[model samples]
Target: MRKVSTWEVLFVPLFFLLILYPILAILGNITLEGMVRTFNDPIFWDAVKNTLVTAFFAALLSVLMALGFAYFYIFHPGTIIYRIADFMNDLPIALPHTVAGLALLLAFGRNMFGFAGPTGLAFTLLAVVLAMFFVSYPLAARTIASSAEEIDREMISVARTLGDSPPQAYRRVVIPLLGEAIFSGFVLGFSRSISEFAAVIMFGGNVPGMTQVLASYVFTKVEEGEVSMAVTASAFCILISLLLVLFLRLEGKLHARSEKSA
Candidate 1:
């Protein structure tokens, strides 16, 4: 283990405090009464449900796609091919989410899809999912790629030598070694989808009871002078995000313990 530096010890806490003060302030403003009242509203339920559903599917799709890209780049026969693939994987990360959403809208918009707009796509949910997926895939691919790079190639070879096929070696040996990375990638991608405001708002049209998500719903509330509701909604979003982070940490600890025992 490395020793903690003085600058790291001091600056890290300050950085977190800067990040957390707003969340704390938002939570502080919300009364329990306000939370209850907000919860009673059907719109609240709709927004929360949409947020979860969209983020879940978006992260699922992103992680699955990332696996193929990462695997190929990590084990490609030629260095140039892997480098090109790696650069392509990272290209989307550099794109602004809002820009990505606009591109999706243009590519799959009313003119293209031959419908009214995002609302009339052959599948209505496609717009939102594409928007979320566009911005999140890079995080997932990068996470898996980083983990794969650290793994000893000989371990994979040993599995192959034990009569495992190439695909079997990956499924049984590679995936288990990269479990933490996959989970972390899922968390990152999920968080990005949850926080997505500009992309979904633009591409999905921010429709109430339809395309509206938690972040957008909170923005709508604030714009409508529903400060109490907005604060409560923001609180819930923050709480859920924190819970997910806690779960990740706990799961990581269990994995560490199991590895130690092994």
Candidate 2:
């Protein structure tokens, strides 16, 4: 067995204290009564539905946009447009989420789209989706771009030599090879979207059965001094996040096995 280093010993306890302990505390606080009450609450169920629906759309949009960006970055790395996009893609990561939400609110709160209704999109479910997408897009874009960078250029060249056009080559060759990366990017975006609070609450508002999601629901409970309910809701969110992580891990192992078999 390898000997544990001093750094490992020093960091391990810190990791447990800072990260693992909080998760344990949340889970530990869950009571059967609270769980039942949370489960039976119609508002909780509505939040679950809203959260799942918005998160799905947000993640899907992020991945679709990321695919286009990744393709450009991989195939046209020398272009100024690619450079601009590359720089802008990381903006979401650097921006404070509340600031991002405020920006979205300013941009979309009014009738920015011209044809939109008087209220535009703010304080609506669509606003929640946009907020989630704004915060999560960077994760999807970076994940896909990094994976695309690892792809063999020779494969594209060979496909081109075989009379495949660039788009055709991308669709037939690159996309098929990026199955794992695409799934990972989607999951990462979904996970980020689901946990978003500041942005979602700012842009979407905390209106139950409409824009309220699990994160905002928990916040609402906390504001109401319903600690038991908040903890229960938090535990539910953790369970969902944990399931997504486990699903990703399982997918990764299966992808590895398939690669080995091939």
Candidate 3:
């Protein structure tokens, strides 16, 4: 094996100390009694269901919107509209979560839409989904757009030459080529959504069995001085995050294999 560089030797442990150590610490705090309590708690299960369902919807919406963004970004790159949208799409990543939550609250709360039945979407499950989507959209859009940029432009040109309209060409050619990217984008968005706390709490409220998700549930536990329950919930979140990381790694390997075969 090649000798490890001095920089790697110095920084590798530092990286683990900064990153992995905290995760390990959280896991270390997990106790059997806490785990049993968390598992037995109906509220915990409700939060789990809410988290998964809202995250799934948020991620699905993010990926769908990202597909449109990627299409415009790849096919109509020079348009002023695309330029404006491209800049705006990254706003979420830079904005503080609290600010994003406040923005969502302002935009959708209190009869902003006439059909929202007077109270509008704020503090509902839909608000949870919207908050998650707001924060996660940038990740999904950027991931899809980056992958779309890598596709051969010639394929699209050939499809157009064969008399396929832009929409049809995108449907038949671009989307098929974007399968892995789309999946990756959705997974990335879902992972981000599941971990969102500040935004969800601000817009959706921390109502147990309603808008409460795992992140907010953990926060609630911490606030109520249930450190053990908080640790258990944090460990559970870490486990879910680990599974998502494994999925991304597996997807990367599969994509690499497919590319090699191609």
Candidate 4:
């Protein structure tokens, strides 16, 4: 029989108490009326819509970029392309994302393009997408790469031996193996996107209608001392993000169970 340790039981619950208590305390400060009012506001609805659109597009773009990166990283190892892909995938994690925002702003600034955005502004949806993509890409790419590492090279060679084209082999043979990991990456990237504030605000300029994502909305509310609005917006964003992360964790458990059964 296995014995339970005192430190293990005590320490685990203590750890959760430390983390979860603060969140619960903050949430308790929000009255039901505050939530109701925030939901009924047109500005809140606009923020929600913008947040969803931006997060969806950001996750989509990140996954697409991650797939291409993982492909080259797996199939074309020990080359310049592979090194660059590897570096790019890890660079964002190693550095502050504000650098990416700064670089984008400089590259696509008003003076460079002499162009205005949708609301006759310098910052646009494109800037938000790029910033979110730059920050969240590592999650998808690294997750996919880890899965790709588990795949056998001989399986790929077998597909080529059967006269499958390179793209066909990737589509049929490689991507199928990468399914759960890719899904996990998408969820993580989405979670990251919805919670992203600093980079988006820095480069995207957070115009209320055009580029104002939920995180930016929440930040603006907080900065303006609109506590009710900030709490409500933050609560909704946290709920959505928690759901995504929960889904990813559940998928991991299911995958583990299946593997154990196998």
Question: Could you give candidate 3's per-residue lDDT for residues 16-99 as a string of tens digits?
Answer: 999999999998999999999988999999999999999999999999999999889877899998999899997888999999
Clashing pairs in 3: none
lDDT of 1 at 222: 94
Q: Estimate each model's TM-score.
A: 0.86, 0.95, 0.95, 0.88
Q: Which runs in model 4 stand beyond 4 Å of their true positions?
A: 1-18, 115-122, 260-262
Q: If both were scored by lDDT, which would come out higher, candidate 2 or candidate 4? A: 2
| CA lDDT, every model vs. true structure | 0.82, 0.92, 0.93, 0.82
Displacement of residue 154 (Cα, Å) in model 4 is 0.8
**Is candidate 1 or 4 superior in TM-score?**
4
> What's the CA RMSD for each of the models?
3.7, 1.7, 1.8, 2.9
Error of 3 at 8 (Å): 2.9
In candidate 1, residue 105 scores what lDDT?
72
C-alpha lDDT of residue 24 in model 1: 85
Query: CA shift at 177, candidate 4, in angstroms?
Result: 1.5
Candidate 1 has an lDDT of 0.82
- Whole-model lDDT for model 2 versus the true structure? 0.92
Which residue segments of model 2 deviate by more than 4 Å? 1-4
lDDT of 3 at 222: 96
List ranges where model 1 is wrong by over 4 Å: 1-17, 77-82, 115-123, 160-165
Clashes of each: 0, 0, 0, 0
